[model samples]
Target: MAERILIVDDEPGILHALQRLLRHGLSAPDGSRYQVDECANGALALEQARRHVYALAISDYRMPEMNGVDFLTALRTLQPDCERIILSGYADLNALVRAVNEAGIARFIAKPWADFELLSAVRQVLQVRDLVIENRRLADLVRLQQGQISAQEAELRRLERLEPGITHVNWADDGSFILEDPGDVKL
Candidate 1:
C-alpha cells in the first residue's frame, strides 16, 4: 500500500496548502510519493487517524477544539508508529517543549513555512519511520527462525531417546545427506 500523510489545520487554506506541498514534494528514494489526507481541525484529524494508519501527521499548533500537541499525544496511543510534526506561528517556548517531550513529535515547522524545509522534514521522518518498521519486521523474522531451530533440535533429542546408539544423518544445504558413521560393513 502507498504510504499516507495526514495534514491538519483550523484554516481551510492552510490545510489545502500543506497537502499540496507534501503531495508534490515528499518523494522516497524509490520514487514513491505520499498519499495526502487533510483535515480542518484536530478533532477530525484524530478521527481520521483512528480509521487509517498514517505514516506521518502534520498539525497546526492552535485549533478551536483540540490543540496540536494533544492530538499527537492521543494519536500515539492509537498508532504509536506514526511520525508527528507541529506547525505554529507562535513563539510559546514552553508549549513547544511540551509538544516534544510529551507528545513525542518528530519535528516542528513554523507557520508560513519554507516549502523545501517542510518537504525535507517529511522525507526525513518517513525515512526514519520506515527504518523503524523494517527493523521490527526483521527482528520478528529472526525470532521465528530461531523458534523453528529450537523445535527441530528438541525433536532430534526425542528421536535419539527412542533409538539409542543409532547412527545419525546430516544433511547439507546443497541437498546431500549422509550417515555420520557406517559401522563395520565391508561390501
Candidate 2:
C-alpha cells in the first residue's frame, strides 16, 4: 500500500520546497511507492486527514487560526494511528515537549531544515508508522490462531473419553465410539 503524507504550512515557499523534495524520493514503507497531499493551513489539513488515512503529517507550528501542536492534538483524537511532525522557526522547548507528550509527535524539525535532512526525517516517521501497523496486524493474526488452537484442544479432550488408549481419532461421520474392556471380550 502506498503511504499517504500530508504537509501543512502557511508559507507557500516552504510548503512547495518540502513537497518537491519529498516527491523526488517518495516511496512506500515497503519501498514500493507513496502518495502525498498538501494544505496551506491547519483547518484544511484536519479536514483532509479526517476523510483519509495518512501515514504521516508535517505541519508548521505558527499559523493564524491554528498552530501545529493544537492541530496535531485535535487530529490525535480523531486518527490515533497517524504519525505527526511539527516544524517551526520558533524554538520553544516547552511547547515542543507538550506537543510530543500530548499529540504523540513522531519527529520535530526546525523551520530552516536541510532538504535531505527533512526528507530523511519524514522517511523515518513513515517507516515507524508502517512498523506499528504491521505489528498490530501480526498480533491480531496470533490471537486468531490461538482461538483455533483452543477449539482443537476442547475437541481433543472429548475424543480422549471415547478412546482412552487411542492417540488419535478419525471419524468419517459424527458418531460415538465404544471401547470394550480388555478382559471381557468374545473371541
Candidate 3:
C-alpha cells in the first residue's frame, strides 16, 4: 500500500504545486507509490485526515482559519503517529520555535525549498516513523515471548510437583535414552 500524504496550505498555488511535485517525486523502489491529497485550509485538512490515514502532513504556517501549529496540535490528537512538517514563507524564529514545541514538527521546510531537500525531508521523517513502528512491534513480540516463557516455567514447576521422585533416571552420558520407573509409583 502506498503511504498517504496530506498537504494543507491556505495558498492555492502552494497547495497544488506541492501536491503535484510530491506526487511525482515520491516513488517506491519499484517506482510505484504514494497518494497525495491537498486541502486549502486547516478545517478541511483536519476533516480529511480523520477520514484517511496520512503518513505525513505538510502544512503551511500562516493560514486564514487555524494556523499550522494549531492544526498540527489538533491532528496529533486524532492521529498521534502521523508525522508532521511545517512549511512557511515567514521564517519567524518565534513561530518556528512554537511550531516545534507545540506541534511536534518533524521537519521545517522553508519557503522556496529545493525539490530534492523537500523530498529528502519527507523521506527521512517517514523512515523515522517506520523505525518507531517497528520498535513498537518488536517490543510487543518480546512481551509476548516473555509471557509464554513464564507460562512454560509455571507448567514445568507444576509438572515437577505432580511427578515427584521421577528425576532419578540415569541416562548414558553419550547420546542415549534410559527410562527408570519410580519403584512404587503413586498416582
RMSD of each: 18.6, 18.9, 19.5
Those runs of model 3 whose alpha carbons end farther than 4 Å from true positions after fitting are: 29-31, 148-187
Candidate 1 residues 1-187, lDDT tens each? 6777898888988988888888887776678887899998777777676567688899888988789999889877667788899999987999899999989999988888899888888888888988886776566556558784464555554444333223255679888985443332221
Order of candidate numbers by TM-score, starting with the best: 3, 1, 2
lDDT of 2 by residue, 41-137 (tens): 8888877765676777888998899889999998776567778999999999998998899878988999799888888888787778777767755
TM-score of each: 0.76, 0.75, 0.76
For this target, which candidate reaches the highest TM-score against the unseen true structure?
Answer: 3
Which ten residues in a row are the worst by lDDT in model 3? 159-168
Candidate 2 to truth, TM: 0.75
lDDT of 3 by residue, 1-187 (tens): 6768999998889988898888888875456778999999888888776567787899999999689999998888667778999999988999999988988999899999999999999889988987886675566557567784464555444343333323335678895867644332221
- Ten-residue stretch with the least lDDT total in model 2: 160-169
The reply for model 2, stretches above 4 Å from the true place, is 30-32, 148-187
**Local distance difference test, each candidate:** 0.78, 0.76, 0.80
Which is the winner by TM-score between candidate 1 and candidate 3?
A: 3
Decreasing lDDT order of the candidates? 3, 1, 2
Clashing pairs in 2: 28-33
Output the better candidate (2/3) by lDDT.
3
